[model samples]
Target: MKPAVGAIRRASIYAVVSYGGLVLINNSGLQLPSMWIAYLPMFIGVYVFTQWVDRKF
Candidate 1:
């Protein structure tokens, strides 16, 4: 149960950081060719980072 809670918290933090970064980029006037172009890499990056953190820790 505790591990589950910790996993959820960690994932939530990653999600918030990714979302905030996207928001910042959108506000900075740089535009991607498509929304999927922007989102897909970000999603993959977050997933990779999370896996790395879990493994390293």
Candidate 2:
């Protein structure tokens, strides 16, 4: 149960951070050759963060 709660917490954090970042980028008027390129780093960062969070708690 603790692990489940921790997982949920981490997921929420990831979702909020990802959404906020996308929103900021969209509003910043920065042009990208491809959106996938932007997503690549975000996904990688979130994955690494999730892994760290899992190990942390």
Candidate 3:
């Protein structure tokens, strides 16, 4: 149950980042390159960082 809760928390964070990025691209006036491209590195970085942190602690 404790580990499940942590998994839920991490999943929520990922969802927020994904949807928030999409919303920003839709609402923001500033022109930019593909929004998904910008977001990919961030998502991957966060995932990798989380794995590293979990292993360390």
**Each candidate's clash count:** 0, 0, 0
Tens digits of per-residue lDDT, candidate 3, 1-57, equal 989977877776667665766676568764666766666776687677666655554
Query: Which candidate leads in lDDT?
Result: 2
Q: Which ranges of candidate 2 are over 4 A from the true structure? A: 50-57
Better of 1 and 3 by TM-score: 1
Once fitted onto the true fold, the runs of candidate 1 whose alpha carbons sit more than 4 angstroms away are: none
Q: Assess candidate 3 and give its lDDT.
A: 0.67
Clashing pairs in 1: none
Error of 3 at 27 (Å): 2.2
Name the candidate, 1 or 2, with the larger TM-score value.
2
